[model samples]
Target: MLVSIELVPRSKEDLLRDITIVENILPQINVLNVPDLLRFDLRSYEAASFAYSEKKDFNVIPHIRAIDIAPDAPLPCVDRPEIKEVLVVAGDPPPTEQHEVYPNTSVDIIKRYQKEAPHLRVYAVFDPYRRSPKEELEELERKKEAGASGFFTQPIFDTNLLQLSMDWLRDETVFWGISPVLGEKSRRYWERVNNIVFPKEYDFSLEGNIHFAQRMLQLVKQQNDNAYLMPLRVDLGAYLTELQSFIVY
Candidate 1:
């Protein structure tokens, strides 16, 4: 199974620093996913270009927010030979309503990319928490029909939910997301803001998060699916070292 790491596009210096850290800590991890954050100055593809410049071997999958691009304009990353894939998302609204955005949905962009750039593999986002399993699966089917070659899901906290979603997407290429929630505040943010359903005995410490990630990775291995680590608000190197040790042993 291929493992990936999510890198936030903040600045050239920060992006390179994190890439180097991941390279030194876990050389096996070659896929770096860059998300498009409207609040940040650096666009996802720009940050991904920086990463590719630093390490040619890394498979950089930059996220393209459908709302940011017009229907007629070309994607900035599609022509680049180094970038073979992209993850398209509906994207959150801009921090302020002042920024102009297109009304395009992810499905619209996916279909357009498939027709316009057949060589580039497009991916769709799967949010299990936002809708019911039945509804989300139906929407995933819609994205699949739109010519999305694969999927990348939001972080799932429950094992049963993971299993169910994995079963639902059994034959597709999926990268299950895993992130660490360090404290009660972070936990509540997931619970209230993101609608994450955590188990009653969910661990809130660093070790607890590491153990859960290991378990998730093992399950993903058993199912022959890929997994991605989104180490939000944690020491990337240390957390990856621990997770890597689990894989090594």
Candidate 2:
């Protein structure tokens, strides 16, 4: 199984913590994903990634949103030799009512990005937690046809969701997204920001959330070998000790 960690550092303090977290988890995992979302600073993401790279022999994959990328503009991370893979996402639009660079769906981004840098393996976003599985799978099919190298899923809170849709996952190279929701504070944040509603049966306690994701990881790796842990601005250090103990390979 390929286990990887993802870090999102919005400021210098977070960047320092990201470095410490990576350093603390040294030799535990090599692959780390740094996605560019929210404020959109490619240089900061690169700098943080470079810091992590200096500490560990890690294959740090930085994410670039398609809308932020201009038409026929230079590919920043893709052209760089250190970054072999890039996660291309049709990220959420800016918080304001009006924004520059109108949104392009991930499929649209993939086609244009592949043309721009065919050598860089592009992993498109995959979240099957939608209301319609058929529609989601069909959208994934469109991405598959567009020459996306792999898929990155949203956090899997309900394992039954994946269990019911084995066929949807078996075909692609997936970096399974798993994260610990600390408590109601985190839950409400996800709800307010990302529209992720906590189910009535959802466990909101800190230990419960971590164990939930850990069990989900075991179940997922039974079928797929790749698991990606994304601590979306959450403190990853808290989850590291327990997660490292649970993962066998």
Candidate 3:
């Protein structure tokens, strides 16, 4: 299994610091959900430089937000030779802005990135439960047609939901399942932090969190031995460590 970490920095300095810490521990990690439309100014450049400096072979796959994909426009700066892969997401617009003002979809970005960076691999995000199985399959097909190399799902809590998605998409392309590690407090904290409204009946507990992750991993492995597991959230270190232990055994 290839273990990677998602870098969600609130600022350029924090991003650099996170990369520095990651470098000291692991050789490389995938930088997740980086906005492509942001200015490649001094601070952003410095953050990228520091990340690359830590591990020359580190794959700095920026999360290419869907909105940055302008129809027929030039590829973003992250498509440069230095970056080798990108995770394309239907990014949420900035809190202050409306998505209607955005120009492109995740597919458009994938198509442009594939053209500009022939060596770069494009990973698209899919949410199965959010839509019908047919619609999900159609979206996956659309992404593949637009040049997506792989698929990644949202933070999954139910195994059946994942199985349905995999059954529909198994023959189409490879996919990575998102297993988030958010303890009770952390989950509640993030819910508020992201302005996401949680169910009033939601129970936040460590046992619940671990059960969710373990079941998801089991289902993914059962469905396909080759399926890649991509756990989300910052506290996934424990889950990764446990996964490593299983591999060792």
Question: Which regions of candidate 2 are displaced past 4 Å?
Answer: 11-13, 40-45, 96-99, 192-197, 232-234
Flag the better candidate by TM-score, 1 or 3.
Answer: 1
State the weakest 10-residue window (summed lDDT) of model 3.
37-46
lDDT of 3 by residue, 1-249 (tens): 343455554566766666565544443334433434343333323344455665466656566666745565566545366666667877666545542436777877777767777677788877755567678778888989888877666655555556766676677544445445456766665555443344444345545555555555566656552333444453444555554432210
Best by TM-score: 1
lDDT of 2 by residue, 96-133 (tens): 65556645677877887678778878888777655477
What do the candidate models score in CA lDDT, each in turn? Answer: 0.90, 0.71, 0.57
Clashing pairs for model 2 are none
Q: Across residues 10-107, which tens digit of lDDT does each residue of candidate 1 receive?
A: 89999989999998988878898999998899999888888898889899999999998976788768778888899999988889988879999989
Q: Candidate 2 lDDT (Cα, whole model)?
A: 0.71
Candidate 1's displacement at residue 30, Å, is 0.9
**Candidate 2 or 1, higher lDDT:** 1
Scored by Cα lDDT, where does model 3 land?
0.57
Q: Any runs in candidate 3 off by more than 4 Å, and if so which?
A: 11-50, 69-73, 77-79, 98-101, 172-175, 179-203, 223-249
Clashes of each: 0, 0, 0
How many backbone clashes are present in model 1? 0
